[model samples]
Target: MGHPMIQLDNLDLKLSLGRLVLNVLYIKSGFFYHSMPEHRHSNGSYELHYIPSGHGRLIATGREFPLSPGSLYMTGPGIDHEQITDPSDPMFEYCIFFEALPSGRNHHERLYGRSGGDSEDIREIARLFLETPFWIGQDSRQLQHVFEKLAWEINTRSIGYRRNITIQLEQIVIGLVRNYTNNQPTLQTAPLKTLDDKRMVLIENNILYNYKHITIRTLADQLGLSVRQTERAVHKQYGMSLREKLLEARLQEAARLLDTTLLTIGEISEQVGYQSSESFTSHFKKWQGLTPSAYRTRTIVPTIQ
Candidate 1:
């Protein structure tokens, strides 16, 4: 029997990643169709599709796979795939296509080379996707929530919406990696559990409260540890040095102020605990390419326009 046909409605598109060529498609009820026929993306990019409602079938490599609600379908470079929608009740899906960068290493090197894992990691991920084409809602609601948020971001074309969509998509990718890692035997080893690390937790809370005036020595004394010990423990648990983490938190607060308040660059810098506006601007520029003023203008002015 042929796989079920899917129908979608209210299609929306967003492009991201400096617009170097990223495409996001959000299909709602009536407009559920592809303009082109079965095709292959030979330009060495990656495609990911998330099916949240209805049913469908995916035909690829001379094989047919039924697609159902909560299904995730991904095809790597040079893969040919086609989708067939349900005739009666069309499906709603979020699809994205983007170019993948080279890892500059051997297969094994690529797999374990980066913080996000590598090529072999990607292959393992593809296997998990193919194994479960239908991710029923029974799975964790967190995944569902993330997918719904992603769909919403794609559908809404607000200011910085493209950048926001890319962030959401990256979250989805990380979620998949975490989920897959949680189940794999080799990866199931107890993650340096921080939930019960009271000292680390206390230090984090203290820094959060007094981030503006925080110093390594003060934090170490409060935690009853030497400065070196405190630094080591914090780094071991969070993967970032204590100073780096504090700066990250401060920058995040600065970004929030920039987006939500009418605070000027100097005001935001002081509010976020930076003594000098120039220092704050330098730090912010390091993390985000645009300076404080430019970022705020680029991200905020579009709303008025």
Candidate 2:
């Protein structure tokens, strides 16, 4: 049977998106020698381990899941799970770890996140995946792609181009929930363009015409979605938040001007919709780790030589 898509409504996701904050997310893939350490994650994390090849056994709470190619296992925070790898054929596992702020149960919170963090009506929602059992014998290359990009982002110097991996991780967990429930979402009445696809087409056309000043609000209003919703849509479609996407556009424009024209910093800043050169410098530095002048110097120096 095919795996079911996530039912977002059942998870109360619509009510929580505005206040949700991703606290931590990390991905790692490696082969083990003898066994995994006997350890427990913080009571706030949810982890998924997928074995790509080799052999092993996952031991958690007196349960042993035989590890094989395409085997998947999940563990909740503070849940002790161990792995015994075959000495000859060591287990190669892809692991994902994450935590959502204000997602814990009965979290002591303050107003406006002054003390505890964002308001929380349901503390146990994010934790449900922790309590869920391991999913074995599931081959998911989609999940593999998510991890691959996450690993790239975490290891690379592309920090300014923010990417939200948590969203995909949440979807994966929901897919697992669907499997647990054995519920496949009903097919759509008719085939239609997805909201994300439509938005992408619109954004691309706008960018092709005028990328000098594209803001989050512009994209949000065009799609009749709130800023957060629009950002989520962008994340779903491109694996990047709208802010990062727009910044990347602006950065590209700035690069082109710097490489081709002799515009002053103030002029280039205004051309890219910045109110001041200082503001432009700060943002540019954040993305490229260099001021506009410094970048120009570096790029131009190579040409002169």
Candidate 3:
């Protein structure tokens, strides 16, 4: 029989690296008892591999690296690589495929798009990965535990498992970066002022979870920021004013409800913080070019797959 393999994709897993984000596209783990064919990833894609046990050898770009227990390595875009197991001792490995790119409205741009105006920090990280296309080292971060936990979470479908998996995936990437930079000075990121990152997380969480009743003043108090400060902060991070952000959040929730539920327009309006169905319809049309009913009809119909 062929070697057993476990694979997971179609996951909405993402993690932030300052302003940029890494989106994990797939994960695979298995024991290898055979020689694998040489292959290369597409532009902007990266494959990170960790061998927790057994023996193997990896050939990357005409360079050879030994793989044994605790072996960790990364192969980035356009790098040709292959793995061969030492048959007597098959190698067991975990691998993750991901792409790092801009997030939010700027997401359409590649990590370092043609314009080349992306953050220097992002460019630096990308440069390091490209210039050193293949990295091999021993895992000093106990990342095997993380990979194990990630597999467990994915297989068990336990409560909060999605978030748990995201966290684990984030840890895996971070651990790999740490390994790469072990002897190097800490990588500089486009600064988020002291606590700014935490503050943005809080602000976003509040808007997403409490949009129904959140107001500028209440959110300001929660962040220990004055109303003006709160407004400026939201604009700075999202390129939208506080009112626009709230409107976007409410409309987004309204659209989700429309797509997934049978609730009436009035109910959705109330649930998403609209004082009246008329107001909800008006804003929905202005924001999405479709009224609630039209939007729902477009999204809720069952499609033949």
TM-score of 2: 0.41
For residues 8-49, write the lDDT of model 1, one tens digit per residue: 322343332211222332222222453212333322234566
Note the residue pairs that clash in candidate 2: 76-130, 104-123, 105-123
In candidate 1, clashing pairs total 11
Please write out the lDDT profile of model 3 over residues 1-305, one tens digit for every residue.
23235588755677665445666777889998766545544344567898888898886766667889999988765466667788899999888876655544453244455454566665555445434556778988999888888888877889999899888977887677777778353222221222243364467557656766788898899889999998887666555777876787678667667865799999999887878899899999999899999988773333211
The TM-score between candidate 3 and the true structure equals 0.52
Clashes found in each candidate (C-alpha, N, C closer than 3 A): 11, 3, 0
Q: Using Cα atoms with residue i matched to residue i, what is each candidate's TM-score against the true structure?
A: 0.39, 0.41, 0.52
Which model, 1 or 3, shows the larger TM-score? 3
Worst 10 residues of 1 by lDDT: 185-194
Candidate 3 backbone clash number:
0
Evaluated against the true structure, the overall lDDT of model 1 is 0.54
Ranking by TM-score: 3, 2, 1
What lDDT does the true structure give each of the candidates? 0.54, 0.55, 0.70
The local lDDT score (0 to 100) that residue 99 gets in candidate 1 is 38
Which one is best on TM-score?
A: 3
Best by lDDT: 3
